[model samples]
Target: MTNKDKSHLCWTIAFSVGLLFSGRAAQATLPIELEVAMEPGSSLTAPQEWTRILGKMNLSRVRLRSIRSTDQPSVTHVQVGKSTRYRVLAILSHRDELILPKKHFRMQDRRKLQTYFEQLPNETQRNASPRGRFDLTEKQFRRLFTELSQPVSFATEGKISSEVLHQLQKKLTLPVVQTPRSSVLLELSLRGELQGLSTGTALAIVLRQHGLMLQPEITRDNSMQLTLATYDSQGDAWPVGWKPEKSIRLIAPQMFEQLTLEATNITFAEVLSQLKPRLKVPIVLDHWILTQREIVPDQISVKLARRKTFLKGALNRLASQARLATEIRIDELGQPFIWVTQFGKDSPRATQ
Candidate 1:
């Protein structure tokens, strides 16, 4: 049998974290016993790929041990009375894994978005005022475009402030200018919901990828939510032909469900539809791994686990806020595998 086949026999008895080298049939003995201890706080060398494989396996606890090679041991065997247990056996070794270290991680400013939007010329004001009159020059248009480049930030604790709304009003009132080439110039302003450079920029990048020009604004009615209202596009509402510049970006569940797209790509639409299913679901951070454990038909046991972790901003926050626990089982083969399950005090229930 292969090395993996022999390991399964050891696994049936207890957790084995190391390898077991087979000896000649003549050297085999009865009732071998092994002792194990852990090297605390060890980390996994390859976390994501490994963990993804582990999660599908559902087990109660995982055991890990450390050792040198199993071929020969300085301390061979120990005896108690008439019985002797192998004092030097193979051990399982585990690498430590990372988790969310704290409560929350957020970026972008909602109050700022509110202020930006409040300043914009609303439909009512525009209706009351005359159109097609201009005092703004090309330099002023460039200034407005430059203003669009500021990143958005979000709040973690409370609602956005009214002061942010006032600021938006001021920024939105800049003079609308007509270009020398006669291409219509409408000042576009967007108020951001989430805060932080990555989140804000991701959203902005996505909007830009979609071919729509946006400026930031802030409002307070919604907390932990994304609200997109086309405040102004030129002198009109959001126009056609504009597409978001970035796709495949990260979003919190709150916003994930709220956001919508007008795209025709079937695969992309499928992904969005999955994100917005009516059922309230766990926000599977982009790098979520699923794993499973089972007995194979062959006597040679195989235990497999999958792992996935991403370095995106939202994931960084999740890692900062999470703690991971893993359970594992060994089979006839010396292969060590994990059963990965996640638990949280505030964890959302799994959805259908």
Candidate 2:
């Protein structure tokens, strides 16, 4: 054969082989689109069923290797390969029957799952449990679902006062207690409609306007209670004038026993202030003692020779000079508080 013919033949073979491989690659990457007539109301009841159905769906490019249903109802363990779209579609197709088991619905992207859950019907959500049903009461579940799933979208003209806000909260079925001290009477000029925003988000916007927030408290009956309160920057929202004895008892010994002193000519009050942030715990001076003595914390110079000393020992040594003693007190919530009182006065002692 002539060199020119042989060259042409080689080029033709190479082109054909290239086309074959390209076709194979395209076919491998293409998604399998199925048009099955799924039974109405038919759903995969368990993780095994989900796995089997996904396998039969010819998702060769994707893998749904395993599904674990035995975990918490809000969590699902799904082992999947690179294709997230198929997995999301499969889960959504059987969303009503599949217990997602995840605290947050997440797919290929974080926001996709959030958007999906936001659009889920209340009935579908109630049924989207691994156990096939929610254990909470209808009212409880409704409250939770509304808070989690519903987006807040409302615009109001004029100023929104605390009273008006309280009324609005009632309209949303959120319970409010009208306490004389608990009234958050800040007026806000709010004007914006939230789109696809959770109830918590809506409440946060309203609360931020008034420098307040919602906090959960345990009632005397051991039931959960939601309260509107002043926003604490430090995130310490203990009851007013309340101490934390239980927490202090549990924490003080560990914190103070290892306390090391290295102050150089700093006032006792300054020392306390420095210790306060370092300890990362709550410590308050006794108001009665401060009022009675009219002593300034910054004025009282504290001289502690650099030494690693236990908190109790350091406090005892400094107490005489500062005219103050330390005590752990309990609050209404059974949490502990550290109180610095007059050294000689009758005061509560730390729990052993």
Models 1 onward score TM values of 0.18, 0.30
Per-residue lDDT for 25-133 in model 2, tens only? 3444323321111112323333334333333323223222122342233212233485422223233223434324243331223454334433332323344443211
TM-score, candidate 1, is: 0.18
Candidate 1 local lDDT, 67-159, one digit each (tens): 334422212334569753333222223443221112111112334423322332232223333432122234433443344334333342123
Off by over 4 Å in 1: 1-137, 154-161, 167-192, 197-352
Q: How accurate locally, in lDDT, is each candidate?
A: 0.27, 0.45
Clashes of each: 80, 13
Per lDDT, the best of the predicted structures is 2
Poorest stretch of ten by lDDT in candidate 1:
98-107
